[model samples]
Target chain A: MAKKAVQKAATPARRASDAGRAARIEGGAVVVTGICGRLGRRLARQLHRERPVIGLDRREFVGKPKDIEHHSIDVRRKKARELFRRPDIAALIHLGVMHDPRLGAEEHHTWNVIAFQKLLEYVERYQIPKLVLLSSANVYGPRPDNPQFISEDAPLLGANRFSDIRDLIELDMLAQSFFWRNPGTETVILRPAHILGTVQNAPSNYLRLKVVPTLLGFDPMMQVVHQDDVVRAVRLALRPGVRGIFNIAGPPPVALSRAVKLLGRPTLPIPHAVARAGVERLWRWHMTSFPAPELDFIRYVCMVDDRRAREVLGYGPKFDLGSTLRAVDEERWV
Target chain B: MPARTALARIGDVAADDVLPFMGRLWGGARRSVDELAVRVLGSDFEERARLLQARYAEAGGDPFGLDLETAKYAVMTCAFFHRLWFRAEVRGLENVPQGRVLLIANHSGQIPIDGAMIGTSLFLDLEPPRVIRAMVEKWSQTLPFVSTFFSRVGQVVGVPENARRLLEMGEALLVFPEGTRGISKPFTQRYQLQEFGTGFMRLAIETNTPIVPVAVVGAEEQYVNLGNLKWAARALRMPVFPVIPQVFVPFGQMPLPTKYLIHFGEPLHVQGDADEDDAVMEEKVHLVKQTIQSMINRGLKQRTSLFF
Candidate 1:
């Protein structure tokens, strides 16, 4: 019944906003934000192979892809679309999500939440046909009661657990709203579970640390997708007519202990009860990289069922569990 | 979670025997003790591994993440108590079928020792030893190290999905429908069965699995539940905090020698919709409850003394 109220409230606001503009089909160039990052640069290049793209970010791609026009500006402020070559870009790919834990709540709200709102305002104005938002599966939050394979429809209980998770859930909620409100903009939210590779990580505690500390009693299973697979999923989302939320998890869920071993690192087994308090102290002392609540991830599972992504979007992950585990950079020990 | 499949595929074989011999330090009475333990507890190492392998094959992975070697250690430890401490006598073993079945039993002892004894009976006493995967009480999941310990030992938290999936995979499931009431109810209501829940009946109907009514004798006197420390348990997020007065006294913590009799009834088949009306489901549940109640009565009547 409460959900009914949310739906009823969202529909009218959307329709009221849509009443002002003349109904028209959306088409033109594709605009990719966060184009300087590793994933963004590759995604822009892939999109550019099919059609022309306008790259949006404050910096240039280190090895910029061919024929992709670049625009330099922060999306937080005024009419940033003026820099675009054309008014109507066919799609908007948001990959500029900031993931550093050092950023406090206000900073996260500004860049992750408020700036995303500002981008949607631009998307609403342009009536962009498609929007592919790459979100993290951490939105599920690690919990003991979580099913072995959680589907996309599982509730978002992660927001209140960790301070950093709040922004991710907020961004997802905002995108979901946009998905329902403006049917014209086909918004596809890709919740990719722990993407492991040599280059990048998905807010992982296992990476960067020489000796990973895990709860002695708890060895939660993990579902990891390869970076290459994530690229393929995001590319599939940008295609002509794909929409809705999908869990972009890959095959053969691996336990946290096994995953650490596969990465060629040793682990320090700590008591599950004391681990939280110890991690909190370590976080406060600036000795540890992750926040206090992230200890929950190491203790409990947050794996998702991604068969929907394959069935609906035709996304096929190339790397199996073994290959993906092997792909992680052993030299990445920080 | 994918334990032996990939590792075995790469030819780094998981030892065929669940127990890896600890070199020469394991000599003397230790070797004789292990053999005596296995003989008395009644589990062949090879047979245990074979059972676990079949279970792993059906489940596609170590879904519960049970370590067979550790489970063997646990079984050996439990068998000492089950065989000597309780002197348990099990009956009607052939009534338990090979495929998926729910053993609806009355829980006692203010804890799960009754459940553990029942599980040991199936594992050690049966011809083709069956690992009875018991579902944990929901509150038990909140206990920090305890929950993980339970999972690693192949006991899952009692959620409907966990039960249904395990049943669909043709696993033998153990459920105490009376739940916390059956186990945690004060010692005054000890053998008196509490009102049974109909969830198990609905699940049995849904999966088309047979239901076996079981009665356990002598567990009721284990740890007397004087009263529940509701406030303390609530603050600690525990299900029920039993105020066992016996816990305070030295050697009082141990239960008095109480012989246990486990009687497994015929696998009664119920035909109906899983989502049928509550009245219909409750009526079926009552039938199973009555069967168990009668079994408990007979076991109590046949018991000659407390410490047999």
Candidate 2:
């Protein structure tokens, strides 16, 4: 498959006329894990236009595509060697790191880390040449000492705040270690900033809330990317000759207070200690939208430098902070 | 004891009634002042702003989100401080280049009134009116409204990446290489230069930016920082806790009005390996520190009194 990766549909890097330079998928099958996800659905559809795609997940995807084969099997419990018995699976795209609040700590581990390890085992057994793993920028926990644009070299510090997201850090290490160990396989780990579009709009939800409670003395810098851009980045990562970890954050980071003001929402300032205590209680009562540890994100800067993604994958974000905020505002109003 | 007294006072007057009155009074004054500022900026101000926008075209901040209407009001407010409050006199406006340059100044006083005055001078005194992004201390980023206020006004955390980005975007960056040591030094040590951190020098080399040495006087006389309480700083996780007698007095916490004099030295273009030894870099950084110190000494020699 001689595919020149188009990270975003409207990337200024790749003009419409130059589309001839990068070829689309011609032969071989593209295996997409967690096909039920909104991202997975779009990715499968986009990839399906070129060649055959096999989507593996536990439940059937909503609005299942006719061009793709939907395999309803839990990758962890089942053997993928049977499915790839003929051995034509070109790549495995894992988009299954679900932040479902209902899942307990143990369930999250099984769903995230264990499932990822199981998939890696299958990749080696099945000889999948390309692998793409999606990780969140939150893995680089927001801290007072964090650099302005945290490089990919920065340590995974999420375990310092929330025990729940510790698996994300472990998953990144596993992927990186696998990349180093295996000489044949090409692994791309994308640590994207806050994803705000469709279902993955946690930041938007928090920003849109009336009388949003913010840590009184802290306002973290926010770097968000549109869902379409994230999809585009994954496409570029899936392209041949692109490897190694990359930070995928869109530019013009806005302060949390400014984001709320842009959304026409008022903020309720609470002292850090008091807010932490209140959020802990809210989490205990199951009255909060997210876990208590979510407060730390708003309290410090978790911005990532996405220069590598732009340089290596030619992934330039189409939507900046202001445009993204306007989109969020319109979405909320409607 | 004050809590009981406040409750008794609230009990005497209906809480709801007093709250509304206070809110109405405050809101009315704030609205009129902002409106008055907008009006005072007058007709040609908008035109000038539109012209200024084109200059910052390459600047990598939120272009839609800058709120220049608010920034204008802020610049006007700072202009007042620059003209009336401090009676600041700035020299060598021509020394500052139109494009990227690093303004290295001697940091002074426990409070950062000096940095504000320098910013005000650049905005009001210079042609093209560059919106210089002041690199802020790391500890300040942890504070709530302060960080937001700083960022909205185009301030960023004092890190290599932030400075590099701003400079790369051809922004005029203001940095105090002395950092906390320079800003929080005791009153007795006023005007004396501290050991300059070589990071700025390294950054200067890396980005190929011209270094503009600045000296600010009279800020040291703002608040009498008798000394710093080290234990309190450690406990509070704050960088410094300066013990000033005025802090205990009623309505005396504000810095005393001190006339400020800012001098901009020649743009020193340094070229060397940023990866060289710290000792080698210190030799280069020492020149910048010395330049600021001499300027401060000259300004102090010309000063007549602490406050008018």
Candidate 3:
């Protein structure tokens, strides 16, 4: 009967948002934000070996670790809302979004949707029982009528033809309207897909270039994942009764010319209107960092369906697609 | 920088000596084109393409890409138009059962060569050799080598969530639902039947599958189309400008060998309620379009000559 009147008005709004706040949601201090990103410093060195991490980032956390607490401010400062006036912080993650394309579209919409809308208003005024966000599978874009896998209820249309992915699809629609106006904060979001390793994204800098190019008669079917499997799908979306929007994807889909012949490089091809007019004249002569509608991610099928993160956040991908395309030639240091 | 590591040691010695001698001369011209496709598809067409490439390499492949060696050279070029240009003659290939069925055909020629002669008679006369899949036109995934040869030959993108994930992976799909309106009708609306699309009877009543029907009969006289220009198919954004006067001659763009036949029928099963009412899925899509219009009127009354 209308799914039992939507489970009788969703069980007293999920038991009045799980009653009193003392369910610690796995004890204190995660915070993380853009903790000097290389995927926010490998998710703050694996969430500081199990909680109490903090970091936030205006950049300098370089070799950071001594019991991690960095905080170089500006997450749109008022001294970054004084570290959410700590109520033992347990989970805010956000992975500080930005994505450069040589910055200024008004500093990429005030650092990606006004600093993730002031960290979702300090994760809804610090009732922070977990939040996550990471947000990507390129906001559902590389289309040509998608559906090869797609599915986290599909439509974001990745900023309809890449208007510089409009603030990461408006910060994944402001973490899906703060996951419907915070039913007491288990937000989640993730999205994943083309992550790949040694993070300088854009499919790990188009599989660390030295020839790559493609699109001539477009190959498509892509997917990717492994930035330590998006830090293990943000540690299973900070666990405690997992929240929504999952998508994470990793190994299965391959053919963008067999992932550039499984990265043994050598590609070139061109002609999608001469590689979108030579990557839009080498991205307006700052000499290329891609963006010619990101060559419709090598021309189409965006790829996703991580079977609801392997049946609800038990997630999967422990790397194999030859170590997730050899983590973009790991440690290719200068 | 020491001349960029001596031009990365001569681009790593021409990627270790000219890409493995041009991948061993492209693997000896792809093993002499799979030995000229097992001497033109016979001697048990390489054990039915190695049992359908070990059933899609034991499922570690075909995540809607298929590539069983590009579907064994697109079933050796549609088994040369199903054995020498539409000499097709298929008939009830054992009413095509075995797992997750559907077929449902009747899309006339005008081009999908009766879906490549019913996917080359279920990959060259059935018995443990299925393949089929079909769907396509989601703007042929925006073209470029017709979307990588329709995803390495299994073909997909006519979404109802890719036909309920190729009928939940027990495969054999095909469909047609008279899309592109029965392959661009006109030759005085050939064997009639056009309006089908109840999205494959709500994907065969939401995946309890079995539908079959098929009935091809010489792809409605191959390419006779005589009409549809629809303002030059809306100024060339295409989906039907067909007016096929044997495509302005020359090789007349091939088609008319005509003699196909096909048929199949039997399987049906079809119970109801896949979110019911569209006048009950158009009366079970008019009982599978009146069983493919009485099997294309009993295969055009057992045809004796259309080019046979």
Which model is ahead, 2 or 3, in terms of TM-score? 2
Residue A114 local lDDT, model 1: 85
Which residue runs of candidate 2 sit more than 4 Å off their true CA positions? Answer: A1-26, A204-220, A250-278, A318-334, B1-67, B228-243, B246-252, B304-308
**Mind giving the per-residue lDDT tens digits that candidate 2 earns over A75-106?**
87655557755466777788888776657878
Candidate 2's TM-score reads 0.82
Candidate order by DockQ, decreasing, is 2, 3, 1
Which candidate number maximizes lDDT?
A: 3
Residue-by-residue lDDT tens digits, candidate 1, A161-203: 7866688899999999988887767788999988876555534
lDDT of 1 by residue, B1-308 (tens): 46677777545333533324333446755889877866676547567657876767565466556656566767776787788888888899999998899998998997689888888888787767777788765555556667667766778766676788788777789999888888898877878999999888989988899999999999998787887888999999877898898878999888766898999999999998988899988899889999999999998898889888
Which ten residues in a row are the worst by lDDT in model 2 chain B?
B61-70
lDDT (10s digit) by residue, model 2, range B1-308: 99999988887686768878989999999999777655544335556566556554445544213445556667777766666677788898899998999999988878777887787677666777767688777777677777766766777777777788788878889998888898888989989988888899999999999999999998888788889999999999888888889878886787777898889999999999989999999999988888888889988988888775
Clashes of each: 0, 5, 0
